[model samples]
Target: MESADETNTKLNGKSPSPVRSTRPKRSVRLTVKPKCFRCDKCKCEFSDQTNLDYHVSIHATDKPFHCETCQLLFSKRASLKAHVRTHSAAASAAKKKVFKCDNCGSKFTTSSHLKRHTRTHTGEKPFVCDVCGSKFTQNSHLKSHARKHTTDKLFACKNCPSKFSRGSDLKAHVRSHVVEKTLKCDSCDAKFSKKSHLVRHKRKHSGERPFHCDQCAAAFPENYMLKRHMRRHSGEKLFHCDICGSKFLEKLYLKRHMYTHSTEKPFHCDTCGSNFSQKIYLKSHMLVHNGEKRYQCEMCDSKFLRRQHLTIHIRKHTGERPHQCTICLSKFLTSSNLKTHLRTHTGEKPYHCDTCGSNFSENSTLKDHMRTHTGEKPFWCSICGSSFIKNSNLKSHMRKHTGEKPFHCNICASDFSQSSSLKKHMQTHLNKYQPL
Candidate 1:
């Protein structure tokens, strides 16, 4: 079985193209926080004493609040109260339950939480956005949605001046600056911010995949990962784009697709000023400018910007072609390459030119075909300065420089750069062999 990481990585196959621009440079210096109280456990520093005390609690093995029956430790009394409720049903009933529903027997800790839950059974959308026709169960959700309509981003990051509409989003952004790896795995010394993250990371080593999909036999380490995989089987796309009315299984894909309708590329590379629709794409593009090929093949010294590319390149060394064409049984290194090869058997010409109704099997072929209509010869020979529509034509033209003949004639010691000239030369030998 393939790992959860491999499955998740393969799902995001669509790569965004970087927009090359030499615009005016803008320098945004990253905010550096002063290290005051440093923890002896992880050596992480905190800005305040209160924050330092909170950080120390994560590493603390002994807790003051302990259950008499289970002997399970909890730092907070409220957490102990919640944990005790899981074991004893009678103890849960004795607790101060503020929110009780009349429709259902469900009880909540707070009234706000119960109000949110009540909406599910009542089918009531009390909170509606004024800007959009979108309705929400809670007022908080409506307020979060309303931020998109207005330029009111109250939560600003101290690490950088980056602002977010939601406080939760701001907290997540702040984590990048303050939080390093707080929790460490016992199997491996690999660290994580949260204990839950450490638990997920340890799964990779222990091979403990507890979460199983009901639709398929696929298993994952995390429940959220299992949920993500189920979307493929269920065909349930919750996220919808307002602009195109197109639905996506994931919100990240929907955001990436939104770029197609817009002319703006907000995420720019500091090194090259190359713009990208997504921040992740910009980070990947920056590797090109920095010459940072971190993912290297073990067999060969060949390096790649992305781990996916490295994985594909490693297959070349192993001769392991996992992606196979269903029709022809031909195997390929990558799924994209397999998809292209499958088209040969399927006779699927999806790409079409608008100018001329000519269809092409590949998008690249259609792009090259457009050059004929526009008379655009982008590929130019460095030797002769002669231009051609295709790079292959320009490559053949380059042989005039050093007179490199790749194709040779058997009859005579004649060589040609162009394969057509070699074929025409072969005809002479064929004529000579023919009896009159």
Candidate 2:
């Protein structure tokens, strides 16, 4: 304490200073790294080089990140990872709980799905769009409807100039470019691009109509057909033709009606070298060449090439006149007959002959009238090779070859091949009974 340490402590009442390091101190070198990695497209900046490269990949047309579970592709790996999780979650949830709707007995994996399905029966539309004020049963459907208000088309066709707001619509449009139809019908030569279309086509051969309408006794092979049938009851013609301003119940009917505007026949028949405006018309024409009467009437020996013709022919035996006129209350066997009958009341002669300036209420009548200008006799007798303008004329001429006297007089009980001949014979009986 009385030494140099005590003298230094007594002077300031403190201890001596600590010794410092002799080696050079290292500087921290605080460098603020700027976002040097900038994207050429969109001009997005990122601190990390890997993140910038990922952001640039989004602008590329090709999607490198592939989901093995669903064959879905994404631009970013993170998005692919998230989509993979959804597949896993769906698989797991399917195995776990199965939520069912009490009203419709529809089974779904999640309670949310069951709730959304319950809205179909209850007619509950909880989600409403702010833009168009349209209501939807689910939030996802509302989101889809909201896209109609915006002009932003995110999805575009690579092969065409068509752009779609929805990815599903773009996917459906891409199917048009597919040249080959993978789904083939085992019963017929009909081929389809989609499995659903093939399944529906097979129903035509099997006569399996699973879908039924609640409002009527009508049944259809597909659910869409049942939905289309409901439009008849509603009297809703939503689909419109731009050329003729004609409205149709369905888009398919509108599409078929569009062919009337143009003389171009795109569909060709390979067998007869004939052309048709629609593919369905070509298909129906091919049945004539093949002589394939697949549909047969059980009530009579008469057979028809088409199922609809057989259905109408069966109604003749049943006397079931379902279609009725609202104005005159006249019942018709078929809808076409009713439509033609209505034209008689309205005096709507839509079909006109360009050559003769003659008008006809029915298109078939116009076609027959056009033959007068062209001097075309399509109907021919097989026995005598005699041609006629109308099918009725050919049918009447066929009785000469077959010796068929269908018309009989009640007075003389004499049979005549033609009705005109029977009328002339009835006059002969009347002349004999006259007082001389």
lDDT scores of the candidates, listed in order? 0.73, 0.77
Q: Which run of 10 residues does model 1 get worst, by summed lDDT? A: 89-98
lDDT measured at residue 5 in model 2 versus the true structure, 0 to 100: 75
Q: Model 2: residues >4 Å from true position, as ranges?
A: 1-234, 242-245, 261-275, 423-436
Clashing pairs in 2: none
* Model 2 lDDT-worst window of ten: 236-245
lDDT of 1: 0.73
The C-alpha TM-scores of every prediction are: 0.41, 0.49
Across residues 1-436, which tens digit of lDDT does each residue of candidate 2 receive?
Answer: 3999779888999987878989999988987778988776445678889888877766565566776543456877888898889867865774665686676454567777667656655666788889867666678877887888888876767778888887788778978886568778998989986455676687789998876665468888866687688667544454655444456888888889877644468998887576788999998898898877878888778988988899989989999999999999999999889988998998988776677777778777876776788798878888889999899999999998899999999987999999999999999989988999
lDDT of candidate 1 over 1-436, digit per residue (tens): 9887667667987444568888988999998778798876445678888889877775554567876444456776766898778657634543766677776555656787667666665657788888778876578768778888887676666568788776678767877786778788887778876555565677789998876664458888776687688666434455666654456778888988776544357997777555677887787787787767888888878989889989988888889999988887889998879877977987877666777788777666876787898898878777668999998888888888878999988778898988999999898889997999
Off by over 4 Å in 1: 1-225, 232-283, 297-301, 374-376, 380-384, 408-415, 429-436
